[model samples]
Target: MYLIEYLKSADSLTIQLSLTLLFVVVYIIVTKLTDRIIRRFGRKNEIALPRVVYTIKYFRFVLLVFILLLLGITWDISFEGLSVYFLSFFTVAGVGLFASWSILSNVTSAIILFFYFPYRIGDRIRIVDGDNSIEGIVFDLNMFSIVIKNEHGQKVTYPNNVALQKAIIMLK
Candidate 1:
């Protein structure tokens, strides 16, 4: 009864507030539903990789951000006033990411190796490095480097980026 009367008498500001609340509720429901579905799929497939898990989280974040942006536009939040700040922030972020290129490349290679690498742990293999070809058993796989125990019993840790670039031979 009170709610009906309020809605009937709602001014422009009140109506706008109600719409904003509705959008937020919808966004929350969508984000939660998507997360639950992805969680179920991950559990069913036994997806334990950080790459896949992070991708899902990033996707949800991006979706929520897009929804928020839409809501901002709907409520007349001024992008013109914020554009310069966004540009400055991105420029700084670009430089930082560029400075960490090597680390980033190795991490990217690790993701590729996780999905497409054929060799298993304990497999004997040779990475064709010309004068310093490495022949060893695969000891361990890490996010940045792969560890192999060479013939002389010394463990060699090669960056994953290099591993992806070199040709590998399985010696069985």
Candidate 2:
């Protein structure tokens, strides 16, 4: 048949289109599976709504990065060419924003807190910092820091890194 002959002679655009569809299918399946796992784990652990939402967002961001990398490879984008572009951009970013590496550390801390942390929101906790100890109710936690409301009704923003490093006493 003419249709069979045409199919046997797939063009470059046809090949690219097929590959794109394959990648999209894989991405969707992986994303859905990961999302279900996160939600199930969150429910089992009784994680707060805000915490669960943020965790999902973080995971989706990672998946997006992976998909973009795959897209580049599928399109035959030159990594050698990209290396030159990224090298200069990263060099400048590294010099100007080197001090902000703590932000990444905080993000790592946030992930740790999301899973292994013992306390939940609304639990009263005291961080032992010698005489300058902080006693407050756990308020909110995000990508950067954990918020706490002290007894005097003041909100304290504690860096996630410090929160992880210090000793905490659960008051409630």
lDDT winner: 2
lDDT of each: 0.79, 0.86
Candidate 1 Cα lDDT to native: 0.79
Expressed as tens digits, the lDDT of each residue in 1-172 for candidate 2 is 9756865798867867777888889888988998898888889988887777778888888988888898888788999999999999999888766868878788889888988888888899998988878899989877788889998999999888888999999995
Worst 10 residues of 2 by lDDT: 3-12
Candidate 1: segments with Cα more than 4 A from true spot: 1-82
* Candidate 1 weakest lDDT stretch, 10 residues: 46-55
Could you tell me the lDDT of residue 110 within candidate 2? 88
Q: Put down candidate 1 lDDT per residue, 1-172, tens digits, no spaces.
A: 9988988999867877887898888888987887777667556554444545654565577888888887777688789988999899989988988987778788778767765677766889999999978999988776678789999999999898999999999996
- Model 1 Cα RMSD, 1 decimal: 5.9
Please estimate how well model 2 matches the true structure, expressed as its whole-model Cα lDDT.
Answer: 0.86
Instruction: Please report the TM-score between candidate 1 and the true structure.
Output: 0.55
